[model samples]
Target: MTNWDDFRLVLALARTGAIRQAGAALGVNHATVSRRLADLTRRMGGAVFERISGRYQVTAVGAPVLEAAIRMEAACLEGERRLRAVSPDMAGPVTVSLPDAIARVVLLEELTAFAQANPDISLTLKCSYAYADLDRSDADIVIRGASAPDEHLVGRRLFPYALAHYCARDYFDQVALPDRRWLVRRTPAQWIERSPCPEAPVGYVIDDIDMLHEAAARGQGMIRGACYIAESDERLIRIPGSKVEPWEDLWVLTHPDLRDAPRIKAVMGLVTEALMRSRALIERGETDRCRG
Candidate 1:
């Protein structure tokens, strides 16, 4: 009988083609990878790798073994997801990944409420710009802005997201836009060309939306951000004549294999309900200060 673990190591080595790289990817040492490969080759009675141009290449005999190993890995992962989905108890960790801005301003309270309601379930709120890999169990759920979702994953479209220009109450002045300093995310060019205050001078280039909002509130300069956050903030005032900057559709995504998990379902239900209830605020930027 062939050991699946040995085959997994072989597959990784074949995929990476370097002992150091494969070891790093598999969280093992280079010596371990070499030792394991030697043992695997001896057990199989054939060389699985061949040196080609000073790089390791899978041998003819190893190709089929690698393919089988990949299939086995997929099957095992799917089985785990399915088993987790069918768990009768609602006790486990559910990691939810989303943009830092949304997590801080919009989802924070709702997430807190959900956590309080479900003490048995542990929740990890990952705030990041990088997309989490649902297929590999990087996260159990994800809230993201996307125009199109992967066909393999199951997702629910939440609502449309939009951005607008805003400034602190004291920062607003009826002057040439070029004179005012701009608080931007990446660079001023992308926002300025499309913004109402196109020529606003660049001052601060911040990556984090929450920090940008704070700076704008302190009268640093005008800032651009999601309408839901800017409108709700009392310290910031929306710029007059600013147009809605529609980005992408917000979505709640999960792996197809774990879509039926009770914990995932409960979290998804609460999150969906919360977002649905705040649709007007999130989509239309409905706020008492819209006129201000």
Candidate 2:
């Protein structure tokens, strides 16, 4: 039988190069370190380490085993940390990943309220366009846009992800859109045709939603973006009757293991309620609905 404890002795000895230091680190006597190494070498039919200059020098064959031992220790430590993070108790860390645009415009104030409500649970909001791996626990909860949600996770589907054409409040008044350049994410043929200024030349092709929103707010040019974001910004106004692009279903997802956890459930409930309350703004740029 191969005991990982023996391999750990090998790693500790390799790192420190002295039996006394290895024994102190492992909370064992120096003789126990030497005995364990000798036993491991005998079982493997090779000298795991050689004593030279009163220090343990790893044999050529022992280096690979030591490396494996080090990797195993790191993996175990990470596993323990993850277990602590997902503890059954209500108090612990919870990370939610979502698109930057949504996080900034839709979830900013709602999330602040959630944090205030659950002071025991330390919450972290990670913003990214890329989907986080729920199985690996890249994020405890993730909000994403997807046509087909993963079957493994469980959560609520809020609404359809919608986008429409928009521009600064006084952009057209300052410059005729046909004469100015178009601000767009990508040059999609269909989108170009649907834009308010289809004949307008390209001004800036910004793929990042934040930058695109900024440019449009600054009266750079017309942009097509998420209705929730565009509607929330007072500086931006929707292009009248512009084609609305329905992208995908917006969902809040969590791993099955955490589906029933108290803190995760609490956060998910808040998000679902918030989205439900503002579904019109997110699904349609109904400026009147949100405006007081």
Measured by lDDT, the strongest candidate is: 1
Ten residues in sequence with the least summed lDDT for candidate 1? 170-179
Relative to the unseen true structure, what is the C-alpha lDDT of residue 133 in candidate 1, on a scale of 0 to 100?
87
Q: Which parts of model 2 have CA positions greater than 4 angstroms off?
A: 1-86, 289-292
Point to the candidate with the largest TM-score.
1
Residue 284 miss distance in model 1 (angstroms)? 1.7
Task: Please write out the lDDT profile of model 2 over residues 1-292, one tens digit for every residue.
Answer: 2688977898789889998999998999999987887788888789889989987899987878888888887677557545754667778888999998887877889999878977888999989988898765678899988888889778988779788888888877898645776787886546776676668777868989888988999988888788888888888878766877777889998877677778888888888888778778777656673321
Taking all chains together, the TM-score of candidate 2 against the true structure is 0.69
Model 1 score (lDDT): 0.82
Evaluate residue 7 in candidate 1 and report its C-alpha lDDT on the 0 to 100 scale: 71
Q: Write the per-residue lDDT of candidate 1 for residues 52-153, one digit (tens) a residue.
A: 887789898788888888888888887877777777778888899988877876778989988998899999998997889887788899998888888788
Predictions in order: lDDT:
0.82, 0.81
- Score residue 89 of candidate 1 by CA lDDT: 74
